[model samples]
Target: LAEHVVADSVLVPGVALVGGGPGDPDLITVRGRRLLAAADVVIADRLGPRDLLAELPPHVEVIDAAKIPYGRFMAQEAINQALIDHARAGKAVVRLKGGDPFVFGRGMEEAEALAAAGIPCTVVPGISSSISVPGAAGIPVTHRGVAHEFTVVSGHVAPDDPRSLVDWSALATLRGTLVLLMAVEKIGAIAAALIAHGRPADTPVAIVQEGTTAAQRRVDATLDTVGEVAKAEGVRPPAVIVIGAVVAVGPDQQP
Candidate 1:
């Protein structure tokens, strides 16, 4: 059906890398939802909530490429191959990723692979988890008095240069917040880095999990104890970590 719609356009044999948004089904954009509905094959990650999957037509094929804690199924290469394979078969493929496709979802790598294979590709942007998670938890990444700026860091960087990717010293000097996405596993190391580099040990920290979802949960504490509280509270990965004086103001308190 999608092929028919694009039959005249030389670009029908392509893949759509769609962002499924951050866990919450409602967060999915109308364009993303429409593309998903038209997809012949949908490849999704763990963070792409199952609710979104259920929205697909019974006839559409849904593939799980999710990277979960216990399951390390498909590699980037394998996922790329799968996308190409389906596209070559004249299938309208949708790589349904959690959050924005380009934001740390490795959508760029996949796009490069598809391009190499001469596959047409387009992106459908969705809300990024880093900022949305914090906002949904009643914590603004930036505030008038509390923060004039903010930095977003990823945990998937070179282990030796995580600090280099972000200047802890500058972050310490700025009156702003630090948003760490995918850094749940390195909370201890990150906290230590910021503290050692001059960010106050008592900087407020909050970890929000399953953000914007019905099951959303939050753990709040100072930088000195966020790591401990996160562990003790059984906070899982795929959580958003917020640090700064801004979060100190109660959730109801606005900037």
Candidate 2:
């Protein structure tokens, strides 16, 4: 299990951006956990596990590099500087992210910055809260009998032009599942677009927040009303929005 990833790439001399996996410390992969234990400096996101941070050696230096969601805050430049400084000290630094580093975790941006600085950084993938959240809430992204295909999209986009990257018309007709991550703010617009594009207004949808963690919460409703219900339920980000017939497979379960 562990050999496949690193064999695909090399662990470099600079910082390693590790995925902490959803919010559960236990969900961290074996190799990832091992790396955590060996890290000399650990920088993590807001959604990463508190318990995972606690697992680190007491002497390990830690930094909080989280950006305030939907708010103006820590610029990527500042984070890059932190990584460079730590690595320059010849310390084994790990930049831990909430979910998979590649999935909107800004891992790419940091990697690019590191590359420009002649630093060699490694990326360690983790379970994305997007897929795991939905599954934990009993909504499989794809079910053989129900859905054969699925799409995952970041819902954090400009409200006016959210469909720039997403083909709303085609997605509505996919008849497959659509898992939207970080879309709590844009859920209404997203669902409305799907409905307008022929996706059933009553399509079953489940909003799972803090997915795969002890704080996980699920809210079930149809596409037409999920946004409203989710709002009333106070669902936040660090969420996964699952939509399709598969959601009906376990209708009795509540989040």
Candidate 3:
């Protein structure tokens, strides 16, 4: 594996996994931005700091991981191969992902593939939307004396789905704040499962759409009403759903 180090902000010819932060371009880290600016080939996702793509030099090759010539987005294997191919060609590659690479970003999978291919992979952390999005909506996942702990979970799969690995029963028993990503469509099932277990139906819940972006909107409801509220409001994906008493905690408390 070609081992490359980011020395004095200099990026060598290898693959750098840069976290583009939640949704705001300004939220991207200094290191992430610097790497993007110097990248010879940037493989980007739909969720990252897309605004920065226009700033890249015309000579840089920008590959949309979510879109390909075949009319279907590139799959994970294809993305890994793209990185390897670009880096093998001596081009500095940047795999720009949304939020922290390890936070449900399939970053570890990419890193493993790169390592297997003997490619030097650099991981740059970004602010996860789990916490940042809630905070942006004026809700803290953990508040002093309110929620002592916070758990971040992916709601991409419904509780009734056999593909789901999450222990809804165990999660219902926890007293900490629950931050759900990709759960808007399955909020009803999730709420039912949680309520069926041990979670209180009256627990406060806040759904923040578009998170920290300019289109951010927050909707409030109790666990009993959240499922319907989400549907009634036409909540969409990329929204952060916060469940627990912390939703009602500060000056930004929602109705």
Candidate 4:
């Protein structure tokens, strides 16, 4: 039955959740590139390698999956429905996302939805921005004898938010590296929380904006000063915040 299903799937339409890597179009895996080139329709998020979309054939259809229409963002249910609808109509659908599809990109949710609807789905992994973004700024997430372990967390919610799963106090005591995503808007509160919990105010921090792209820029500061430094520099979203001794290992670090 399994072999028959696999063989039968070849002739049926399916969904491919392809990770576009960290902003750079060339960084995408060969398999991902081939799949993108063959896709009949693509549903793309704002953060992926958008340049690749322009390279698609004129017959391919593209949809902005993340666009906010009429002051409201497109719901996840709607996105899933669009994918199922397109695939059922015999079109090869590619749901392209930035970075790794599983790393906070909610690719699993879409996969589950497709499964429930009896649609075949495949996942292609991409390099997560959690690691590549820091590397783009010359900051290694883990260095030899410097940082042995690294933790990646989403800073979209304030430390004090009731829905937050992270323990700010516990994170403060950890000696390893901490990489934060979507935290630019709440850096002040997050920085204050770390300091209040016991992380030294002098801990080195690096913020890499638009990492891995030509527009990439790096800003260095201490834990206590990162908030103000980022604000003064006009650092925006789609940036990565790296905090630890590893930040000092970068070539751009100051004495």
TM-score of 3: 0.93
Candidate 1, superposed: residue stretches over 4 Å from native: 1-13, 67-74, 156-166, 250-255
Tens-digit lDDT track of model 2 for 145-200? 88898888878873459356767778888988898888889899889988988999
Q: Residue 187 deviation, candidate 4, in Å?
A: 0.9
Highest TM-score, which number? 3
* lDDT of the candidates, in the order given: 0.81, 0.80, 0.88, 0.89
> Which residue pairs in candidate 1 have backbone atoms (N, alpha carbon, C) closer than 3 angstroms, thus clashing?
none
For TM-score, candidate 2 versus 4, the one ahead is: 4
lDDT (Cα, 0-100) at 253 in candidate 4: 64
**What residue pairs are clashing in model 2?**
none
For candidate 3, write residues 1-255 as lDDT tens digits: 232335384535468999999998999998888888878888999988788999999998999997744335358878888888888888888999999999999999999998999888889999999999999888888888988999999998999899999999999999999999989988999999999998999999999998878899999999999999998999887899999999999875545
lDDT tens string, model 1, 1-255? 134133233344489888988999989887777777678898889898569788778988988884322235358888998888888888889899999999888999999999999888888798999889998998888877767888887854523473446665666566688888887877877787778778789988999988999889988888889878888898887799999987877546545
Given candidate 3, what's the lDDT at residue 222? 92
Q: List the residue pairs that clash in candidate 3.
A: none
Residue-wise C-alpha lDDT for candidate 4, range 60-106, written one tens digit per residue: 99999865232442588888888888888888888999999999999
